[model samples]
Target: MLQQSARDFLNRQAPVKHLRSLRDAGGSKGFSREVWAEMSALGWPAMAIPEEYDGLGFGFTGMGIVLQETGRTLTPCPLLSSAMMAAAAIVHAGDDAQKSTLLPGIASGEALVTLAFDEHTHHRPGQVAATAKRTAGGFCISGHKRFVLDGAMSDQLIVSARTDDRVPDGRGISLFIVPATASGITITPCQVLDTHVLADITLDDVRLPAAALLGAENEGLAILEYALDAGRIGQSAELLGVALEAFERSIAYLKERKQFGVPIGSFQALQHRAAVLFGELELCKSLVLNALHRLDSDANEIAATASMTKAKVVETASKATAEAIQWHGGIGMTDDFDIGFFYKRARILETMLGDRYFHLDRFARQHGY
Candidate 1:
């Protein structure tokens, strides 16, 4: 029921053409505010948030369902950044007062929050160079963040910085919730290949109250990891949706397009390729489902499962999109075709949160390899 409802809603309100319209218009917002408000009314932003904080408390699996539907339509929204990553961090580490103050806004879609952790071009969460030094009033943060999802339009930013004298060490990390409009903060939009907008943020002597600390200073790595794992699983679910949609569209094209009075799908080679993709997509579905379930149930296994799911899904989605374009031959490569949109989206998702290589390495390390 949840899946159907989400699919129906996204199909009606935010189909692939919605993304094209937003892209063509050169919209700074990157997504539709009206559509996002409707999503809020449907309680999507509150899916994984706790009930006590004016949320649905549905769990990660439920949120994953909604995210998968979004992927199917190539919907441009902050559901992954604000609703999943930033919300998970606050839920896992925020104090009672903080949760009470911040969560309700997120649930209502009145506030947009995103996690800013990456300092380099790669996905090294531990190699933070951002500094947060103690001040008489509270703390002052100074650093730059790149590839911040939804950073340009975010209402709040959950930034990770070094609080102790541990350069590039994970032990001294801390997270702080800072208003995007705060003094000495600059957000610059970066144009990427996909329809989404990423931002480069500069924090120069940005001061905040002591209460802004998300968790214990120098003890926030665990909380960050927990939230990242959840995000990785959520991304995996979205990738699954992308692969499915691309594969489905390619299959339909095969059945419709013909050569010499016969459908291309009747060719043995094309059939074999489709069969392989079908099997791999099926496996990806199981892996993503298991990862989502583990996030809701088994904490100890979440890290490993998240990595495995992310790595596998990334690879499969990459192949699926590539194959989709290949199967479509000439038309798929054209910008006018919707198949190219799936490919572009899949490519961008491949690098977000951690790519295949990053997750594969993490998975091996987690298993003592």
Candidate 2:
């Protein structure tokens, strides 16, 4: 029922044409507030949140279902940034008081939050250079972050900064909840190829109260990694949806398009390509499901599972979208066709969180390879 409802709602309210409209309007918001509000009413943002925090406590599997639907239609929203990623961070590390204060708003969709961990051109969660020096009253953070998802629009940011003067690795890291409007913080919007908005943020001695610190100081690397794994799994679910939709569209097109007075799908070469993609997508479905299940169960091997799922899903989605465009021929390359949108979205998602290479390396390290 959850999957069906999500699919129905997304198809009706936010089809591929919705993305086209948003891109054509050049909206800096990148997503619709009204549509997001509707989703909020339906408890999408609350899927994985616990019931104690005014949420449904549906868990990651339920959340993945909604994400998959959103990906199928290319819907733009903060479900990943605020609801899944930041929420996971808070749940994993935040004190009870912090959870009580933050989770309710996130559950209600009244507040938007995003994680800011990447400081370089690539997605390196542990190589943070941001510094949060202790002050008389609180802490003063100074650093620059790139590719912050929903950074400009979020109400609060879970900023990761180094607390000790150690090397720029996983240790000495801490997470802080910084207000988006905090003084000395600058956010500049950057538009990517997929018509999505990411922010380049600069913090020049941004001051925060002692209460703003999330989790124990200098012990945030674990929290950060936990949140990132959740985000990667959620992204894998979305990528799966993107690939499935693209594959379905391509198959439908192949049947309709004719070559030599017969359906192009009847050609053996095209059939072979479609068959290969179908099998790959099926395998991805199982991987995504397994990852989501592990997260919900708090399995011991979550790190490895998350990395493996992300790596496989990223690769599969890339192939599915590329083949989608190829099968559609010239029309797929044109901006006027919706198929091109899936290809662009796949490219962006491929690099987000951890790319194929990043996940492959992480998965190997996790397994002591």
**188: Cα error in model 1, Å:** 0.4
Q: Give stretches of model 1 more than 4 Å off.
A: none
Among all windows of 10 consecutive residues in model 1, the one with the lowest summed lDDT is 165-174
List TM-score per model, in order.
Answer: 0.98, 0.98
lDDT, model 2: 0.92
lDDT of 1 by residue, 1-369 (tens): 999999999899999999999889885567888999999999999999999999999989999998999989999889999999899899888999999999999998889999999898899898888999999989999999999998998999999999996444668999999999999999999868976899999999999999999999998778889888989999999989999999999999999999979999999999999999999999999999999989888865688899999999999999999999999999989999899999889888889889999999999999999
Clashing residue pairs found in predicted model 2: none
In model 2, state the lDDT of residue 99: 92
Which whole-number lDDT from 0 to 100 does residue 144 have in model 2? 97
Question: Candidate 2 on 1-369: residue-level lDDT in tens?
Answer: 998999999899989998889889985577888889999999999988899999899999999989999999999899999999999999888888989999999999989999998998888888888899999999999999999998888999999999986654667989999999999999999988877899999999999999999999998998888898999999999999999999999999999999899999999999999999899999999999999999999744589999999999999999999999999999999988999999888888889898999999999999899
> Which parts of model 2 are misplaced by more than 4 Å?
none
